[model samples]
Target: MNDFYSVTAQPSRPMGGRRGVFRPGHVQLPVSGVTPNVETHVAIAGDWHSSGYWARQALKMLQEQAPGVRTLLHLGDFNLTANVPWSAYRRNVVEAMTASGLERIFVTPGNHDDWGQLGPRFQAHPNEPYRLPKTQTIAFLPRGYRFTVGGRTFLSLGGAASPDQGKRIEGKDWWRTEEPAEADAARALAGGSADVMLTHEAISGGSRLVDDVIARPNHRLFDERGLDASRRSRAIVTDVWTQLSPARLFHGHMHVRAEGHHSAGRSVYSLAANNSPGNIGVLDLRDLTWAWLD
Candidate 1:
């Protein structure tokens, strides 16, 4: 891959009509890809784990190797946003990414994004506490937007809370749920209208790693309620995935590249981030292929 953020736009395609504010650097239509441009490349990475070295190195590699990359995806866990005293390092990584001049930066917030210290804005409170680029639209965050990329509808769910967990944190009276946003996103995809769904947490069978290890100590969504809360989380998450269908899914959180192929249906690639060991996972957008940085 060449070190350039260039993709011959494919002819435009039919995108889901749902509209919201778009982030800067985000282009929803394939003014060119509507024709299905061949050999287009997009970059995917996740789980920074708050390590600046990983972010710096990942950006360097893209600058050198994937210069033609059309998109830069920082999947999630870019930093332990809750623990860091100040977000200088986090800002540095993102700003460095923008400096790369990739057309857009599509990100999903991870549990660590909460910065437990910052309060609910980290949890998608309409208040918008995080420092988003003045140019970007925080997806699914209160009033974020959705757009298509490379023949696929990339539905970015705002940082969300597990319904059960929200009830616990906000108390039953305060728990306001949208019946589960993943299902809503999935249904839009199932309509065969969208190509891919992007979110911070894995929905039901969306990703192998999230399904198998979400409970691990290292996995952010593991319920603070412990083993006993297992029922609550699954009941809320699984129902949504079951009701909706999605062609492909990508996620970060476990910080490992786990490839999932299901006889049940579509294939999903769970990506890890730059801070995890060797670097982050990178996917070839043309054929939906992916490989982890060794």
Candidate 2:
């Protein structure tokens, strides 16, 4: 299938996404079936493993791709902000973004991040999104955190299963808190339908492109226990998905750019990894129109 969508041509078919919820580039709305013409836009980013150089490059790309973008919604894999080197680079995250003409960057914590520090912060501000340093331009969106931007409401849930779980040390590199808990799903469901959903783990029931990427042999984990745990993490997202039913869901982790619309008119866009093509996209939240560069 063509990954590129034409501004003039029509979205031809249903690509079969997320059991029954999301779809591809050409989205079909639930009520009007026509895409809106809203102006509020945000830079949508994929995972940034933990490189200061890549971080700056990603921001530079965002500035060029969607100039004047005031905010950036990073899908996950921002890395260990609580640790050294990582912390040093993070302190510069806001400065780089501000130079790129962006105001803020919010992360949905990814598996590669240091949840040892983030988990406690979540407990302290369980109901809201809080700045990482209260003075930094970076903020963490707690699980089940809901907010509105550009007249559209959003739900942010960050966490994913690391295929390399058995390859990393706990408390030092990998934190057990990187996976979403049952409580997180419960809280996310007790809210109104979201106009847009941002998550670190892609919902796994189905989505041809996403499923195909997930099935790749390179991503397989020999750690059966870790694989099982990964499935459990996905289950939580799926369960929350069935209830909230957001019109659009954007996620990263698969590290492949994939889009497919659900039969019900909603859609899903899985972003690529940092330093890769399709790693970033510019989304106009008002109308849900987005464009990503190669």
Candidate 3:
């Protein structure tokens, strides 16, 4: 395991990003605080699907677009395929992030992601954020994970149902752990509320785009069981949204950019996949304002 993390183990912090103290162990999922600022901003990224090339491009663009931003809240689909070069991916991503002036890219896993690799890590540290075992530069946010920055609270619940399971082989490219369990929702609901919610699956009935996607007609290619599971997963997301009531909710998986808002401050946005327009966004943590960087 002579990866980048191993090589940089000397004097490296136990975690990748700036670590902070949290509420006493009595509180569940207590969030650690970031260095607050008057205008703290972070990059909101869409699905990378585990493409190291896209990973590099996104970081480079972040440097070009938002040079001062040091964090990324990726909305899942960071798939890790067997074909990917884990070491090179780690090295290049770390280099690109450094060049881009980024601190850490927090990922919420998607349906296509290799959950088999992440499961044990999440189990080991279910109460807090943990560095992705092999590539410690990146952090994986467990379901119902919460954190705060610039006075705004953010919640990350990552996992989705793969409607195209017919095309993906289980244990190889697809995993049963893709869908969110009922307990995940309960854990997130227990957090009470958030100013922002980041998810991989669109919340059911939350956005017109999401509703239309679920109601579309030409999904004959997907199996009924997969569709049923997807509905259930979206229901879980919807339940969380209704319970937590985040002012802003953003997600990936539809790979289409569209947004719907009920009031001035409350909205649901869907981002397209990486390498496409609307894949990148800039969020002002101070006021919870959003700007599309593409």
Per TM-score, the best of the predicted structures is 3
* Backbone atom clashes (below 3 Å) for every candidate: 20, 10, 0
Which of 1 and 2 is ahead in lDDT?
A: 2
Error of 3 at 18 (Å): 24
Error of 2 at 156 (Å): 0.6
- Candidate 2 residue runs with Cα over 4 Å from true position: 1-39, 82-84, 217-221
Q: How do the residues 59-157 of candidate 2 rate in per-residue lDDT, one tens digit apiece? A: 887666566466678898888663557666775676677678666677887887778878897888786555566444567788988765555678888
Candidate 1 per-residue C-alpha lDDT over 1-294 given as tens digits, one digit per residue, 9 for 90 to 100: 111122344332111232323222224421222222322446677667667666677777776666555456666555433345436775666566666644445555554454343334534443232435443422212212345444445555433343235334543211233222544344433444334555555555656566776545533434454333343333543444354445666666445677677665666666765545434545554445655554
Scored by Cα lDDT, where does model 3 land? 0.74
TM-score for candidate 1, residues paired by index: 0.62
Q: What is candidate 3's lDDT per residue for 1-294, written digit by digit as tens?
A: 112111111121212243333211111112233332222566888887667788888888778777777668889887654457766766777788878867667887788777887767677766666565555557778898887654567888998998888777888877888899998998899889888999999887667876887788346678877888888999999899987678999999988888888765688989889788888888865456688876
Best by lDDT: 3
- TM-score of each model, in listed order: 0.62, 0.82, 0.83
Q: How many clashing residue pairs, candidate 2?
A: 10
Off by more than 4 A, model 1: 1-39, 79-81, 115-145, 158-193, 206-211, 214-243, 277-279
Q: Is candidate 2 or 3 superior in TM-score?
A: 3
Model 3 off-target regions past 4 Å? Answer: 1-39, 217-220
